[model samples]
Target: MQQVFVFLILACVSSPGTPKSVDVDTDDDVLTGLEKKTLELETQIAGLKTEICALEMKMKEERDSNQNQLKGVSANVSDTMKVVGDHTAALATLRLDIDSLIQSVNSPPPTPAPTDVSVCPGDDWVEHNGHCILFSSESVTWNTAKVRCMYYGAHLMVVDTEELNTFLKIRLRAPDGNSHYVGGIDFGQANWIWDSTNTEIGYTDWRISQPSNGRTEHCLVVCSGSTCQWNDVDCYGNKKYICQKAAVHG
Candidate 1:
């Protein structure tokens, strides 16, 4: 197209007989066509540039979206891992508890053996001649005193031998001249008997001219006088009593 335009320009310049006005009109028309073509080319270039910019924008947007999706997937994976780790820890703890429970169920409890008794009596009791004796501080009737002794799982002092009688004679002496009842009582029998054992009295330490055999003098006592001899007294006599029990083994 440029060559054709150049040839036309050359023919007009070389033809001496061509009208000047006609040649000027042809040059104007050719210049106008070239300008129109240039305008069209500029319009196409601008449209291409617009399309390329729009495509670039779309690509950029797609890239951003893909990056966001990748990030979301990573976060989800991280959360899933955390949950799995927590579950694993909980399972481990439960397993440990179950194992401990099994071990406890399989094991038997231990049994305690019996312990020996102590040789010495507890407080408020005295050990003498293989016996534990407690002297009552309060005086009461013979029956009441016997009941008191029974409350302690004991019996009133029983003089079964000469040695025990002598011991009682020496120990029964009170500073206030107070007498203590013994386990001896006649009840309705001719012979004195032990109230606790219901057996005949084996020994006696009666004072001089004592045991008048009075019907009312059924109960006996270790008289508080300096003599400390066994004396018959009324059954209802209020006198302190002695309590005796077997000594425990240590």
Candidate 2:
């Protein structure tokens, strides 16, 4: 409207001497140029708006992709942590089982029933629970004591019954109580058996925590005193021992 009004004022101000028809044509040409410039500007503005929309869409897609990747990474980390937790729990349970096994191995059952017999063979040997037994007066290493008992046609004492175990405990008390070597041995196999019989024990009387798994303690002993019980000791150490033999008249 402003351009049209300006074109009308230019027509009115033209000198009477100029031709009206020529001025009208010049005004029309000026109006056409202005309209063309306006149209071109509107086209450029539309193009810029399209480019902005495209850029916004591309940015949103990238943002969505980044968010998905973050979620995947978080899930992977959670799975890894769960696996580590499970392994830790399993290791704890396994450790407990190993400890229980070790305790069971350290404590074993007793020996079998003794052979039937009526009378002991010698004056030095005494009859006890159907077996001939002799408690030595001299102290010696476990190996030496074993050899000495073998020389006497006997083996180290095998307390197969509670009665024998009690009797020996009392007998040792009578004269200067001390430890005595027995027939039990481990042999580093984690199994305690009678060295004399080469058999697994079926009857036993162990101390409060007897038969410990010491590396060098392969020999067994009857500990001294009223509260005496079986114990493991080093084979090379000196200690008194008991000898045993099956009696006659079975």
> For every model shown, what is its TM-score relative to the native structure?
0.50, 0.49
lDDT tens digits, residue span 1-250, model 1: 9999999999988987667779999999999999999999999999999999999999999999999999999999999999999999999999999999999889896576776654545788887777888888997999999999899889988978888877776766666555788788887455899887889887777888778768788888875466777788887877888988888865
Candidate 2 per-residue lDDT, tens place, 25-143, comes to: 99999999999999999999999999999999999999999999999999999999999999999999999999998988897866867765488877888987568888899989988
Q: Candidate 2: which stretches are off by over 4 Å?
A: 1-117, 174-177
User: Model 2, 159: alpha-carbon shift in Å?
Assistant: 1.0
RMSD of each: 13.4, 21.8
Residue-level lDDT for 223 in candidate 1: 59
Model 1 whole-model lDDT (C-alpha atoms): 0.84
Provide the overall lDDT of each model, using Cα atoms, as 2-decimal numbers.
0.84, 0.84
Best by TM-score: 1
